[model samples]
Each structure stands twice: as C-alpha cells, then as structure tokens.
Target: MLVAAAVCPSPPLLVPEVAAGAAPELDRARAACFDAVAVLAAARPDRLLLVGTAPEAESGDYPAGSAGSFRGFGVALDVRLGGGEPGPRELPPSLTVGAWLLERTHWQAAPPTARALPDTLPPGDCLAAGRELAAGDERLALLVLGDGSACRSAKAPGAWDERAEPFDAAVAGALGTADGPALAALDPVLARQLHVAGRAGWQLLAGAAEGADLAGRLLYDEAPYGVGYLAATWS
Candidate 1:
C-alpha cells in the first residue's frame, strides 16, 4: 500500500525570546514540537510530501510578502511501495492522513531562500501542481503539512476567519470524498476528533499525549498547528 506523512510544528506565535518577561515554557513548547514530528514519522507512510512556512530565522530575513506567510509550519514525506502502484480502488492507511493532506495541499508565504526549495509552492496552486506531479504516477501517496488556513479558506463562502468554521468544513468535505481515509491530530478542546471513512476517505486522529483541553485551547486560542502522517499499506 502507498503511504505518506506530514509534520506541522507549532511554535508559540511569538518567539519565546521575544515575549518579554512572559515566562513562556520554551522547553515544553519545544518538546511538543518534536513530539508532533515523531508522531508523523511513526505512521510510516509510503510517499511523503512536506509543506509549511519558513523557519523562525528565515521568517525574520524576508519582508512579509517575500516570505510565504500564509503557509503555516510543517513537513511531508512520500513513499512508494514495491516499485509499483496500488490498485485505484485500494484504501490507504489511517492515522495522520487528513492532517497530511491539509498541510501539503495548502500553500504558505515564505522567504526567498526557502522559496527556492522544491516544496515551496503556494497552497492555492498546489492541488493542480500535485495533480500534475502525480500524473502517470498512480502508486504515489501524498503527505502534507498545513496550518489550517488554506483548508478553511477553501470551504468558507463569505468573509470568515480562515481559522474558524470553514476549516472544519473542509476537513468534513475531504472526509466525504474518495481521496483516502483522514485522521486529524486535533486537540479535543479545539474541536472534536473527526473521522472521515470512505474508500480513499480520511479520518481525524487526535494526539492522545497532548490532552484534549490543552490541544483544544491551542487550536482555538492559537493558530492551528500540528504534524500529520500517512501509514503504509500491507499488500
């Protein structure tokens, strides 16, 4: 089976050093960041594609537009199996599938240097690009890293905060489609765990380690951020 993985790292909106006298827990935050990474890798997907914003230092180097601000922070990985493709009707693994799709499918603003990287495409343009890249490559699976903005925008009809209801709708829509099963690594506090079950649909798998309240608060209070992974299918 084809598998993919995506990792989204959520650093506090403001840098720890910048928050004057605010006793922010850098160690805890960093641990959380790495934990997200670990979770994505564990899913063991076949194909992985990474997406996200420029690193903190890189973000500082470029002017707002020059750097892809819209893109959140994360990573993706794609894996191929047996040097062949899976049947069109086969289903991919669960785990971080939805999160991976959300991240890779969306584009973010980034600095010039980072933009030069192969994966630095705009989220708005990625679906077409991804379709092209996957053309004639049916065996390939996709993993994406998203910050929850683009997905929200895709679903929102009017002027809604990209971070609000629309984001939820997009997840629901993807679940409804035949893309693959999706699982969201959501904070229970932020939202309920969404499970998209269908042939190629996706599910939302919340991270048990991150406790629902804290995760929920993080999603609601802070911008949405998290890592995702796609699991490898066993033939």
Candidate 2:
C-alpha cells in the first residue's frame, strides 16, 4: 500500500541546466519539491514508484535502474533511477525529472520503479493501474509528476483561457487536502480542454491512496511561466 507520496511538475525547466539563464525563476519550486521528496524519504517505504505523464512512444513500465538523460534537452547531464546497472529503457522527460530529484537528494530509501502513462489514458484505466500497483505487500511511496493547466495566463503555453483558473484551483485544492475522490472525479473532457497533463497521474495517485488515511500539505502552487507547477506531500 502507499505509505507516502510526492507530487511535482515535470517540466524540463526544473533542471537548472535545462533552464539555463531562467533557472532562478523556479528556485522556489525547486526548493519545495525537495521538501516534498524529503517526506518520501522520511516515510522509509520498502518500494518506491515514480509515475508520470509521457507521450505514447515513451509510455510504459520502467524497471529499477532505468536511465534518463537531459541530452534531449540540450544538456549533457544523465541520471539513472535507483542505483543498480542501467535498465533497458530510457526514461521519458517526466520520469527523468523524477530520477533527477532522487539524485539531487542522494536518495537511499528504496530502488525506484517508474511508469509512464500516456496522455490519452482513460481515467478508469489510470485508477485501475494505480490500484494494481498498490496491491503488493511492500510499503510503497510514489513520486508523481505532471503539469496542471498550461493556460494560466496570456503568456502561458496554451495562452489564457477563461476556464483555466478554476480548473487549476480545483486541482490545487485536491492536492492540498489529499482528496482522492476529488482527484478521481476530475472530468477528463474538461481536463483535456484545459490542457492538464496531471489528470492521469493524479488519478493514479487517487487509486493508490484509496483507503489510506494520508494527511496532505501543499508546499507549492505557482505558475511561474504560465504553466501550473505544484508540489505537495502526503503521509
């Protein structure tokens, strides 16, 4: 069962090297994400799972020791999930960020298993996957990554949409309270319209957290570059 969870945004910009000169802009988010990751370490789970959104070509299961590189983002940096020899698969951008966070923290709690779910995955399927993931006997912790609405402002990636604010507000609220049902209830149609990449990941979290009495703390909620980036911890 899930013993703890950390929610973070997946933008490549989270890596200072990837962001270059604009790195300072996300310093606060970077700090908050570290704090959330610390929570997972404190939980000392027996198994660590990293879940995120990815393109169809990159979506699938990832074993411990999977490797990820920032070369795709014009940086020579490379990271490997867990600590063993590299697995056969290359992590997608989302899981790459997750691995980066673990490396940044010098994580030693558990070797991580990563899974990248496609953007088009149905809500029901995402939830079912999460439930299945949580059925094992080991104590599990998840580092979930995905972006909220991409259209928070006129300068946002998707440009300003009148409906963006409310949509993100709901998402932020659910993360702050660890409201699994609310997360599972998010309307996929609306999420797609609002350009939310977090829907499937969040729903997966909801499924894993089904009956756990986890307490939540919202550590960050900001859209520095018109993209909704959030950080939270549940324990």
Report the lDDT of model 1 for residue 216.
Answer: 13
Determine which window of 10 residues in candidate 1 has minimal summed lDDT.
Answer: 109-118
Clashing residue pairs in candidate 2 are none
lDDT tens per residue, model 2, 115-145: 9999888989989998998897779999999
**Which ranges in model 1 have alpha carbons more than 4 Å from their true place?**
7-33, 43-48, 53-125, 132-145, 149-163, 166-235
TM-score of 2: 0.97
lDDT of 2 at 5: 97
Error of 1 at 128 (Å): 3.4
Q: What is residue 96's positional error in candidate 2, in angstroms?
A: 0.3
What is the per-residue lDDT of model 1 for residues 1-235, given as tens digits with 9 covering 90 to 100? 2222222322223233333354263444333434443444444433333323332232211111221221222322331211233322211222122222223333221111111112232332333343443345333333323333222333322223434444454443432232222333223223222211111111211111111111111211122222111122211
Shift of residue 64 alpha carbon in model 2, Å: 1.4
